[model samples]
Target: MNGDWLLLGRDGRLSVYLPSDGAALWRAERAPAGPWEAPRRIGGDQELLPGLSIGRGPDGYGHLVAWRPVGTDRSDLVHTTHFRPLLAPLDWQPAGHPNKQGARTGTPAVAVDAQGRAHVFVRNGGGGMSMVAQKEKGGWEPWRDLKGRGVQEEPAAVTGESGRVELYAAVTGGIRHWRQEQPGARPVPGEGVDAAVRPGTLRALATSEESTTVLFTDDDSGELCAWRPGEKPMPLVAAAGPGPVSAVRCVIDGHDCTLVAQRSTSGRVAFAAYPSQQEALGAVWTESGPELPADAVVSLALDADGRLVAATLSPSTGQLRLARRKDEPGLALGPWQAV
Candidate 1:
């Protein structure tokens, strides 16, 4: 469910207005950052994947970053810094880290570690290569290109049960795993990259202190899939076609909650909920009303207290709606507001 009324504009601008007084709070430009002052237009035919994603860290800080367009060759990477509210106007700075060989590096994924430092993993388009970069002390570390094969993309990270940060990346063939190097420790391989799973996009859900689950659609059949920490990746639910999956989050505040918002082939936004991650992949799932969007860029987030918030482009009127999860049935959208 939406907390405040947000107006999602058709021009790709999200105007988050205050619900109480209908005053705009923040308006973020959905554009690509480049060479200090240059503003490059992102997300088009040249750029297969849009160069932006937003996430709130565990410490309640908003993190945002963008990947410089590598054209079709996937080289020439210029990843931006993980910006927070503290550095106004100059919130996003250059990461100051790049591949030594510079084999056309881009498609960087950012995850905040338990200590508040950001961990970025970039994939090389030349030979399905991967590299890990971390911010430490007062500067960013040199890129550590791990030896591996497969088109590594969509890296996901979380502080594991042991407090050590763990990272997962989707491989062209399957999935690869990595952790902060400890002397001579080696990286591991995750489950096979199910051909059914889509490339470059996977939504991860932290189920428990000991387990993490990732959700994606099968590349072949477009069926939904769920992969737990140590379990084999398998089919979760079946879908019509392979459309982008909108942010999947598990809202657990002493209450069992799981919600995944995805778009169907018809351009309608759908929501799926479960008692837990277990139930979501099981035989049953509770879904919300269809929010048909014309442009199809949707995002969802859940508060620490289990309140569901979704933002999407409405297909009918081209408005951005910030809807919340109504405990009842039949589109009882309170907080039924626009941005």
Candidate 2:
């Protein structure tokens, strides 16, 4: 009930906004605020908590994951930090060592599992190496080196039913999936090279109480598709324009499945849905509230009863928003309300 949306601004600040009333909650600035709070350096001696990702632990605690300069450039160290929400503004409990010894880690992503634990993933420096971390009983656990894979980018995760954790990472060759429930597991590789791979990213969204589905955009072709265990990856939508697809979020209500995507080249966001997997699907493209201050987006979220909620930013200003449908056909775009 107490979760806020995070925005990464151009000025290198992560803006946190209240989801309830579209209010500006707070901002995490890069430069030190005052003498009491100095700029924290992380991973390979790089500045930690760079303006990028903001996530929530299952307990509804706010988290900001980022990287900083190790020395002067990309070759320097990058650290990953976790900020547990607190009563005082800018107050947070640090996780573990910012750096994974000396490995250069970048583009870190965080997700809260069903059991209320936070999981963090990053691209490590070792040849075909990556790291995964999870919050344990007392503190952040040791980083798990993911080997037997090529260099990867933009890793994302989600908690499935039965406390199963699924992770998707974008690799140069293709995308891969890893199940944490099984220890010492290598990433299960995927087939086919995406032509529109640049804009494509992956995240597992809940489809039901028992299933979490992985969604991604085809970089070369601009197609949106999803995959679940024991099933072939099915195409949900085809390319609409030339831009690379960046972010994707899936929301399932009853039999209706809505896929929302943002285009990097055009800066446009749209939604499309299918009544059921049996029905043909096409873009139902509706107008978004507005361009977020940074890259904040509106996607589908479900309540406990499985009712769908649209998570978006207010167009009037960069505020957070959540909207519900009328539960009728034609999939109308009703009032734009605050989260």
Candidate 3:
């Protein structure tokens, strides 16, 4: 099967790589009140890895980021705007030596803060996490190391309520967290939260306000775990399953909410929603649909029509599948159809 790949744009459009040809594919609704549009290829030949990221700046333009290998030991962090015709390259490791085989490097994460600036975080070839921010007018600041070792997955980032940017990633024994209060401000180091999360399983979502929610699979038990600002990491559910998770903050039924999706032990994908950050810590999870394949990698998002959408990679067929929640009287997820 193809590697896990996905990009949820700020405009509620979901993009995924076609397994057959490695082409970029996107699906979205035509309008807020319109029907869902069929999935279509977006025109690209690059074979993207699992942790692709997409974000929209204040200018109403979307930015996509991914890592492209240029040589045996080097990979360039490439990005392109929604309106641009070509990808722009960003050197991830200017001074570090080329990465030999079997060395772990993290995927890139990008988020746009309130000031209309884009912030990017990625693991360098030297095994340290680094960050860079876009200038107000145009261009990027020099890369600054966040100083962590053994980061083998993509870092999680969010633009907080007060316009602060917070980043988190799995370190040696726990997760490292960092925050920048304002644009171009120095990053403040925070205490690492203790947890045995599996490498590459951590994902986070930030509200428009002050709280952040982190999700991961426990390395030992394989159960889903969550962490908020002050509270310690807690298990969202007790059963062990394949620990793929994705989260997003969106307005549901006219109320702001955080939605989290995880694979359950029964092979079905389940989802939970909290009206606010305070309620998420104690909220109950609701199962979305029938059993997906046990080995499927799942990604979740809300469509422009405000419907919950799920994309799954079928292990046996090596194809991508799309499913949606039927807005009937109850919470019913539709059957998975080939994209």
- Highest-scoring model, lDDT: 3
| Candidate 1 residue 307 C-alpha distance from true site, Å | 1.5
**Over the stretch 1-339, how does candidate 2's per-residue lDDT look in tens digits?**
111244233232333433222112343333321111222222222234332444554554545454443345442222233342222234233443234444345556666665556666666665444544554564566666665355456665665545555666667656666666543233343333332343335655546655566666666566666666556666777643343232323344444454554432344445566543421445545554444444444444433333444555543454554445556654555665543
Give lDDT for model 1. Answer: 0.48
Query: What are the TM-scores, per candidate, against the unseen true structure?
Result: 0.69, 0.64, 0.75
lDDT of 1 by residue, 29-56 (tens): 3431101111222222222224443433
Write down the RMSD of candidate 3 (Cα, Å).
5.0
Q: Give candidate 2 regions above 4 Å deviation.
A: 1-51, 68-90, 93-99, 102-104, 127-129, 182-196, 208-211, 239-256, 259-268, 275-283, 288-296, 303-307, 311-330, 337-339
Q: Give me the overall lDDT of model 3.
A: 0.62
Give me the displacement of residue 57 in model 2, in angstroms.
4.3
lDDT of 3 by residue, 1-339 (tens): 111244444455455533333334445445432344555544345654444566655444455565555566455555555532122222222222123322326667777777777777777777777877777787777768778777767677766667667888888788888888566685666778878878777777775466777778788875677777577887765433566577766666677776666677777666776665544355566665557776666776666576777777654555566677787743467876765
